[model samples]
Target: MEAHLLPCKISSDGMHVDVQAGFVREETDSISFSGHSVQKANFRGRPIFGTKLPIPPPYEAVLAHPTDSLGDKEPARLFVKSKVSSITLWNLSDEPKASDKIPSAMLWLKLAPLIHSDVTYSN
Candidate 1:
């Protein structure tokens, strides 16, 4: 089976939409209007789960929504590392031009609440 990467923009706790990213999940074979079937997708070179991959050929980009409409309507809780440049968040509702400079207050509002009152969040 062929693997596909759908380009999408994701919002972080820091109130912005990030482009230049893609999503690769363990999806099934292409399903037609009449029928569908399941097949194994073995992506060569590297694993797509729990990691990031650069956008590939064919240039497929789907609007990325942070909401988990499949089961829970609540938005996801993302824990990001410090100084990750490749991932960008673009929240047009707040930040009109995400490519522009990010206001300090806006940046703090997005990232502050997600943090714990401790030294680090991970073990």
Candidate 2:
């Protein structure tokens, strides 16, 4: 899959939109950063806080779409549009914490290798 750094944020909830014409508008200049460096933005009058997190080494986020079946004998296929090394996690109430679901999952991705490694510890 071709690698592409997507400038997108993952949200906890979903929205109903009819068209993609006015879904997103450029508000980068209005973006504010807190003392902790958490990026904040206003979307449709709602405040959202976000932080960019890496996808950990050797892993990437793939953006794909399922294609229609070619025939009954063939299995379904996915067309990978692009891949990203990092993604922004956005929260409606507050900044994303390690305790949050998505953040915790990402943390696990980084910790799983260490936890499963064959390394030995000595005092």
Candidate 3:
């Protein structure tokens, strides 16, 4: 997957800008992967590091967009653009680690089911 890690955040809602040509393609073109775990890229002169994590079973990463044409009383619709079993979590200062907040949260997700399951020991 081609992804870029931008340093700044945009605080606007529903604002569309053409980033494919100016940002994504450019940054992705320069991305370099180390072994199978780490990815490196430069965005606007700042280095970026990323690690790929597989979304555990029964879960996936979805890319969706709001569908146009909504009436005043009609519910909003979304169009699914793509889906993936894993995601590349990017960090500006360092390679993403399992100890990071998001990764830790994913770990909790994996453990929650087991923790809450009803198990009987036959002794």
Report per-prediction Cα RMSD to one decimal.
19.4, 7.1, 5.5
Q: Per-residue alpha-carbon lDDT of model 2 for 1-123, expressed as tens digits? A: 323222355464447654336434232333323213566666567776676666767677888878998999997799987776556667774766778777678778888988999988999
Residue ranges of candidate 1 with Cα displaced over 4 Å? 1-95, 102-104, 119-123
- Candidate 3's C-alpha runs over 4 A off are 1-35, 68-75
Which prediction has the highest lDDT against the true structure?
Answer: 3
User: What tens-digit string does per-residue lDDT give for candidate 1 at 7-47?
Assistant: 23434687654332432234344432213222222233333
The TM-score, computed over Cα atoms with residue i paired to residue i, of candidate 3 is 0.64
Error of 3 at 80 (Å): 1.7
TM-score, one value per model: 0.15, 0.61, 0.64
- lDDT winner between 1 and 3, please give it: 3
**Residue-pair clashes per candidate:** 10, 0, 0
**Relative to the unseen true structure, what is the C-alpha lDDT of residue 12 in candidate 2, on a scale of 0 to 100?**
42
Model 3 steric clash total: 0
